[model samples]
Target chain A: MADNEFLGNVGGRTLSKPPTPGDIFFDKSFRFLTRAFTWATIFLLAFIVYKIGGKALPAFPDLGIKFLFTSVWNSSENVYGILPQIWGTIYSSFLALILGGFFGITIAIFITQDFLPYKVEFALKNIIELLAAIPSVVYGLWGIYVLVPLIRPLANFLHEYLGWIPFFSTRLSGLGLLPAVLVLSIMILPTVAAISQDAFKAIPHKTKEAAFGMGTTRWEAILRVMLPTASGGIFGALVLGFGRALGETMALAMLVGSMSTLTLSFFAPADTIAALLANTFPEANVGLETGALMYAACVLLLITLIVNIAGAVIVTKATPGGDRR
Target chain B: MSQTGLQLPQLERQPMEPRALKSIILSAITIACAITACIPLFSVLILLIYRGGKRLTLELFYTLPPGAFDAHGVGGFGNAILGTAFMVGIAGLISIPFGILAAVYLAELDPHSKISETARFCAKTMTGLPSIIAGVFAYAVVVLVMGHYSSWAGGIALSLLMIPTVMLTAEEAIKMVPNPMREAAYGMGCTPAQSLVKVILPVAMPGIITGVVLAVARAAGETAPLLFTALFSESWLSPNNPTASLAVLIYNWSSSPYENLIELAWAASLILVVLVFVLNIISRSMGGKTKL
Candidate 1:
């Protein structure tokens, strides 16, 4: 066909020739295939919610909304409650967030502030990320053999000397909230640090320069100006870290002692919803007990969904260039 | 002369200002925090090596796990190793194609369409879905429906976790392809599909592979999603039977009363860690090459 020959003209452009039937068919199928894949991906989230929610529905008639508030969880008695697990999940995650968040932000500042050589910074970043690559089960194993024993003396000392305080009231047991919180903090450090590092990096260079130009010290700029500007992203990081900690199962199941209790003492044994699900699900009977466990899973899913959506929103909004990825 | 003489006595270097002291102290604190954050990593690694390394043996790679009361050197988690590989491979098969295709739609076919935007949001949200929930979902959708536990269900659970990660990363990689290349392909009278396959996908292959490797690494390490889905087995890999995996073996054995089982758990932990680390390093290197 001639270059200017056209079977159809659209948008004032001459066509060499119309697409062949085979080409047209292939193009339509290709587009349809990709669109189907995209929809399938989107449909997956909805399907998960539906399946889990439907499975959990039977529990509402038996346990009622009181399931969220009642603490006792005796399988033989047919009365199940996730109150303690819920409390433990929130409490340990909150404490982990505080410890992880502080150190994470500090590490972020340390790496992003040009304090270290570029090569050193790059190596440090990679090392921090390596923490994430280690399996949770391995952390649990190490916690049992190494961390719990290592922290026992300190925990006992705090209990002995400062026993009046609620946080340090209980003596250090073999597996308790303290080790779980510590390990959880370590597990979440990478997420918090990596996100906050991006947040700090997203700040306009002039902002830092302007602070320095105003005769401010490095600390002054970082503490007063940079932190305020990146607070949204940092908050988002903490939220996401909290979500991760809440969902963490294997490590907490091994380390938290799986004792269903509500206590302020960090040394007391506690259970989380995720840990409870993991420890109990395999052996649970296919009735009220299983339904209750599914109910708990539903609750956990709801919490994580809310937290992650909020964090994602905050992060996307706070990012300066608007979705660099 | 008088003014110079009066100022000369006061010109000695003053003591360090409090502001300078505070800055130095804060800097020290941040450096300290960074060091503190690293302590756990070193501790975990050292303990894994010191404890897990002792249990490492050539026999550990090929034997089945010892019975609970069996002697120390009787068995290994060879079944779990194979199971992990088989299930993770299944997950890769399901998610890699779906993720890359969805990415192509988002980054190439209609970058700013409403459906693309919604799909992107859904992928991001799915990234935060708890692995346990994914297991439950699989249990409901696959196990309850099929009336049995299988590696297929486990892979489905893992694919649920893997899809978002692969999709997001693949999308980023595809978008990173230079715009001029696309224009050049079209300028050469290439159709959209042809340009995508020939020009865009070739350039984006490394980044996509990096995502795949990372997703696979993550899937291999996951225990929660496989707990109820794959369950656990003592036997070798079977499509219908429950399967063992390194992560679950570590979880199950770490708590056993037997000293030998504990030792096996440590060894499995070491191997799992090394496997995940290698995958991560591979992905990191590939990612560096692609600069995505």
Candidate 2:
């Protein structure tokens, strides 16, 4: 071993170590190159966020607190505030979350439980994944034409029956917050169900059996034991779904009426931050408009960042305390 | 101690009793929601077939969007399709190598390295950045730098959209390569790079290909990024010139005031959805077969 390590060249001079064919390529230059490339990618990403945000930072010394409160958004007047867009995005996305969370959790339970035959369960799982594969544009197109018409009657009916409520008071517009909420719900459902399924499948079989052994009914076992065990995962799924709904673009842009004005009625025209950017960026005629859009982009970026970090935390906490067999 | 201290006779495990009718109703409702999530897709396909079927002849594949309402009903998505393929190809070309390298840097060399961690955070953040945000960023970077919105600019934006997904997938694929293979390679005096390229990469090729295909499918259906960077074109297909893609074309036609335009939009959307669906099925099957 010592001889092998202190090898000599063919001329018989003692050497420190013999170089192998693989190590031949791992020179100082290659190492430096690899490190440089790695750093470059990192820098490029940071630069993108910065460049998208650089101009917006200067507009508000105090991080645009007042700009966020102002209700007007008249480009010709050089007046731009995002209060309406913020309220609209949050309200609609929250509605989507509430609706999607209920539906997604229920569906997940049904598919994972023993009520269905194994073949039927497998087919349903495949269908769920395939549902996710459909393109967002297809959803948008369908929303614009078919869904809009189909829901118009419902919107009018609601307006008539529930007009006392602030959110349902407006004249029914087929394309507005309600449709957007529905689309967002659909878009987020697959994500929530898929992730929740992973969590459900991970629950210990023994625990479930024990719950059943206690003469607990199937419903009681699922509700009392399985659901709580998977709560962290269910939270992760909600956060991930929120992230997706917050950033959804073409679908929202196409269906949600692009009115920047705020209204209490969910049936009124509205604009989300994402949909606003989609509509305005293409036609941005001046620097400030562009900067404002960048500011909006930065806001979207922050939301996504928070959502992802929170999701990661929940998922990590959900990992078993270590019986790593 | 009942005389013999014998344990009470154990109760037999019973088969699950039938659920209450309400519970059955709840389960049916849950299944309906799953089906509801699929309704838009189903309705769109049915609508497309109803409207575009008669007009979706072979001639529709060879003509351009007619300028006048009645000039030529037989419109081809030739430019849009070619443009989409070309742009997606360029995006895949740019993303895969860089993304794979980033994944390798993350998993193989230093799991806790600051650079890799920062790279990972950025990638995750970018994954949730709306495609429109990416489009705006690309506009600032590519369009501003090049002095015009072009196909090249669109390609850059789509690459940005694609890189994070590819990086995440590649990292998962690479992590699945058993560490013992890497150790064996090193025992034979192989360096990390040699071990990766000669042994690890080949073992992980199926997974990597699956990731790439899925990424391409994602890029192909993206409309928001292309909107700002590659504005629509009417008559010609040019890889060098500013061009619209199938997604963008569908957007334009669907939103136009003309009925014919709307019909063409449905047709194009049908084609795009089918293309994406096929790619998804392939990648999904590949995922099942190659999963470690």
Best by lDDT: 1
Which candidate has the top score in DockQ?
Answer: 1
Instruction: Please write out the lDDT profile of model 1 over residues A1-325, one tens digit for every residue.
Output: 4533553445446545666778777778888888999999779888888888899998899899999999999999999999999999999999999999888888999899999999999988988999988988889999999999999999999999999999999998899999999999999999999999999999999999999988888899999999999999999899999989989988999999998899999999999999999999998999999899999999999999898988888889887765655
Q: Model 2, A314: alpha-carbon shift in Å?
A: 2.1
Worst lDDT run of 10 residues, candidate 1 chain B, spans B6-15
TM-score of decoy 2: 0.89
Candidate 2 residue runs with Cα over 4 Å from true position: A1-23, A26-37, A58-64, A320-325, B1-25
Top candidate, metric TM-score: 1
| Residue-wise C-alpha lDDT for candidate 1, range B88-202, written one tens digit per residue | 9999999999999999999889878888988998898899898889998888889988999999999999999899999999998999999999999888877788788889999
Model 2 lDDT per residue over B1-292, tens place: 3667777764653344354444455556767876775565567668867766756767666677776466446567778888898899889888888788777777677767888777776776677767887787788888888888789889989998888888877777887889899999888766677777788878877777788888888899999899889988886777666896999888777788877778888888778878887898888878876677
Local distance difference test, candidate 2: 0.78
Question: What CAPRI-style quality would you assign to candidate 2?
Answer: acceptable
TM-score of each: 0.95, 0.89
DockQ for all candidate structures vs. native: 0.76, 0.46
